[model samples]
Target: NVYADSIEWMSRHLNHRENVILSLHPHNDRGTAVAAAELGYMAGADRIEGCLFGNGERTGNVDLVALGVNLFTQGIDPQIDFSDIDQVKRTAEYCNQLPVPERSPWAGDLVFTAFSGSHQDAIKKGFEAMDARAAAEGVSVDELEWAVPYLPIDPKDLGRSYEAVIRVNSQSGKGGVAYLLKTDHAIDLPRRLQIEFSGVVQSTTDAEGGEVTSDQIWAIFTDEYLPSQVADERWGRFELLGTRTSSDMTGDVELHARLRDGDDVEDTTGHGNGPIAAFLEIVRGRGFDISLYDYVEHTLSAGGDAQAAAYVELQIDGERLWGVGIDGDISTASLKAIVSGVNRAIRTRQLESRLAAV
Candidate 1:
């Protein structure tokens, strides 16, 4: 209010001045320097002078970066080049020897990140929709109106990528995990599989009591779902050799599979309503009790050789688990998903036995 009254008095006194610049120099004594500067501008001040990042005597001057970015977000051009804010922040930190707060407005490390479940979901959907709209309109993403949830301005506008926009910790949910996988690895998980994997991520983060990086998340995913390496022997008990399917005139599907259990190899066949059902019958005949609870599949890319990803949820004994598989063929991907699930179930049993022994 004092700044406003001063600006009003100055404007009235300088009415007849031919060449005078009414400037504002606000201090941070009350932590209202930015507000005073803006209000002074509205009250007919022609110029604003402040230190960068609010660094000055007392509480420091108004932050020019924050003030300019705030105006830019409101569709007003502040005529400042802040596209590479990281560079600006680095230079400021080096010269001033003061660390920027992680939660500082518009310029902090965690400013654009969302850790909550609902916020992650909304941001994930918003990015997907925005990309789709840009593709449909045949324009660059920057040309479109920025309307993502929880983000006042697009990170790309500030020379930042979406990689760090949604980080996962114990507080995160399924959507955050799915968003990370999709953005980093081009693996779009099914909703149910996301829910299943969120539990795994939660346990990992809880045990570690920290943020889980993308590499660690990928390792966990591969350990649970993908084909194991030489170090992982617990899941290679049963290896699939080949598979063929046929349908009779009565529409009964018969599936033939060549399998290897340890050093022994055999060919087995079963009949049911579909390939999955027939395969389950064959596995049932081999003394493993498994039931398929849910299934989802999608193409991994938009090209001719694009891979297909399949997710399978299985119930073994009383435990429920999910597995993922990727291949060039959709059918093969689905079959591999089932095999992955069976291996995971076997691994779970082995772990359980070890715990019981201990």
Candidate 2:
């Protein structure tokens, strides 16, 4: 700050001098070199001296990347393109044989990240608002103003997806966990379900005393919602090998399916008003106390050849559970969903029996 005052006074007196080029060079010894440089620039400094990533002796120099990005965020073209910040950081590190710090200004790994519960919630809401605005205005989110809580600029501008912005730690809450699930897996949870699953995630993180990655979150989600057999074996006990269905003019539906349960296989037929109903009837006839409580089919994406996702809620022997399935064919996906729910209930009952015996 003292140097800043001196620079301003000298620049004012030397402004009218012929052929005078005023330059300001600040070091990071006080850890305010970047701030001092900015202030000196505003006070009439002609040039700043620094290196990439602030790499220098005695706690590094004024970071040029930080300065350029600072100018970029303020809508000023610093004539330096940090569009590929990772490449720049890598080059700097390779040339200097010194790695950049993880918290180095805008180029840091978590410069735009928010790990706190409230911060994550605010960032999530901010993204939603930005998306809504982009949609209403007929533009990409990148085209709109880059504003999100705890993040000064979009990491995308720096060639970073940074989906890990809301890192999941033991202190994280539902919003942060839910955000990662949707961002990474395209699986959006209902508010109630989000709260419930957040408890599971909290317990896991607390026991581990570490951060949970997005992939781990997805694994937990599948373990909780998909068929236990499928979760492990990739095919459940009640696997739908094949199916043939026909509808008559009288509005009656008949479905014949080759179903497998462990080592046994059977070709069974059932009749109902619809194919799904007929399939459920066949499953019922197999001596499984299962009934479809609710079925929801949602689009995963708007792309052609995209697989359909089915959510099946089944009421089995007075208890209910949810299962999910995905396939190219809607019918197969829906039936797999039923089988998934059935397999899940069967697995739960088996576990209970084993526990009772123990």
Q: Could you tell me every candidate's TM-score relative to the true structure?
A: 0.89, 0.72
- Give the TM-score comparing model 2 with the true structure, all chains together: 0.72
- Worst lDDT window (10 residues) for model 2? 227-236
Question: TM-score winner among the candidates?
Answer: 1
Clashes of 2: 0
Error of 2 at 287 (Å): 6.1
Tell me which residue pairs clash in candidate 1.
none
Candidate 1 residue lDDT tens string, 247-306: 978989988989777679999998888888888888788778889998888887899999
TM-score, prediction 1:
0.89
CA lDDT, every model vs. true structure: 0.86, 0.81
- CA displacement after TM-score superposition, residue 166 of candidate 1 (Å): 1.7
